[model samples]
Target: ITVSNIHIKSDLAIGEEVMDSLAPFIVLKGQDINTLEGLSLRQLEEGIFFMVSPNLKKFSRLRSLDLQDCNIYLQEGKTRSRTIGRAIMVRTLSCFENLVRLDLSFNYLLGCLGEILDALKLPLEFLSLRNCDLNEDDLECLANSKHALSLQELNLSKICQFSIYDNDRISSNNLFKIVFCFKNVKLLNLAQNHFQDSSIPSFCEKLPQNLKKLQYLDIAGNVLTEDSTLQICKALAKVKTFQWFRLTCSNNLLDEALGHLNQAHENAVQAKQRICGLLSALGRTDIHIEIVKLSYAIFVDLMDVMEL
Candidate 1:
């Protein structure tokens, strides 16, 4: 199942039987093929994008699919506004009737989300489109998709990084588009999206009311100003639910590449504690902040910046 770096042929066409037979053995990353509940297609040529598993008739119950960095994008002649949706990859994904977790990270899906959502039969509970070269309009499509009301977890981490050539970064307005759209999201990860403290202070004021059901928020890796960080602290105080939600923020500085990570974590902890202490002194002791580390799905173990 570890089919990486294979240059798919131009005339490649998989029949129903071959696709079904390959489906069961398609769920493996590194050495764990024992749990055959998902399929991960990664590190392949562009031709592999459309020819991998388009006809998995026998694999109807497959619930998870990971197509990370396979250079995914819509084919030529396909426009976003047109409803002529027969994209090969989208059609392939429609085969999964019970898929709840879908990770299409590290590719180029600029304006293809609409067709993918149209092909899906059920509402996805967990969706990770991290670093897929998505634009504002693509986010708009996902926001208005059929799964918007039912989607619980969304990982848009690193989408602003774009792939190498796409120089455009996701702005704060685009960030709030997700907030204003996915109202029922419980876990939201916007880590490493290049936030420069332009409009976050004002947006933090509305964060509580926007994502009322948010339980775990990973805002780590974006270097916001100290005042912006404090603004987030004040915003969390007005969550109304008084329920505990895990929060993580970037260490906001780095002396070297991954070298000052521990210090960053320590510094973040101290900064948050100082902010919360100030709030407590002003009779805002209704909230509690603690530090803990946990692994987000597929990402590295981020030192939990703080907890509440």
Candidate 2:
């Protein structure tokens, strides 16, 4: 059957036998099933198992699959299941070789990142696993994935369980390795994680020139400092393909470093005007309008003072 502009949102449950009878001979041809637009399946009650069916492979034209805020049990009873179970679930989905986008964010899935990476050696272009209880080992597995070379966008934001604390003892080298793995990534998001200023220099040093194809980079809500921001700016300047960027250092100490970015002609015009407007509204008339001429310098000064 052919349907157009349809939206499906339900909480019904069906067993395997029922699913077999109701399975679509051909899934619809709208954005979720056919077009390049991404899918969103958030806060699902039955978890991803609801979407899984013996006949799922029939949808040969499927492209994107999004399963955000899904629930996956890490243990059964008092004992934990072997990693194989998790691997099987992911592998089942990866069988869809045509799938280009996959998002499994906020799933509380624990362990077996290796299995997930192994299954992902397909032609996926976008992947997101934000706040999925991932650790350093998981990050390493993703970085080293053979399929990662084909990935265009990756998001690992708010996965604080991976943070390196004195108790957790995750090494800096492992973190750097993960960052380096995205050398060819076109868009990357690592916001609200544990990255700090100390890790900036190493990260910049190892950043791959192959990232010239990268267009978007989001490093917001981290512990970035002025020095770290400066290092990031310098590193990004070498990338010729970057067109969009977001650095959400709301409460960080990188004002000076971010200010220096105003010197870049690309950022000077709009950024300088925005800052000047804010200052004028605050009745800081003493802050001469001429300060806008030295856009980068003003940026650095404002950053030092945390004014902009």
Best by TM-score: 1
lDDT of 1 at 256: 26
Query: Candidate 2 regions off by >4 Å?
Result: 1-39, 47-52, 74-88, 162-173, 208-210, 252-308
lDDT of each structure? Answer: 0.62, 0.56
Question: What is candidate 1's lDDT per residue for 74-158, written digit by digit as tens?
Answer: 5335466332333566667887887787888777766667778778888999899877776666777888898887888898887
TM-score of each: 0.70, 0.65
Scored by Cα lDDT, where does model 2 land?
A: 0.56
- Per-residue alpha-carbon lDDT of candidate 2 for residues 200-252, written as tens digits (9 for 90 to 100): 88788756364667777766556545456556655665566655555543333
Candidate 2 positional error at 167, Å: 7.9
Residue 214 lDDT, candidate 1, scale 0-100: 69
lDDT (Cα, 0-100) at 229 in candidate 1: 64
Superposition TM-score, candidate 1 onto the true structure = 0.70
In candidate 1, stretches whose alpha carbon ends up further than 4 angstroms from where it belongs are: 1-37, 42-46, 55-57, 75-86, 162-169, 240-266, 278-308
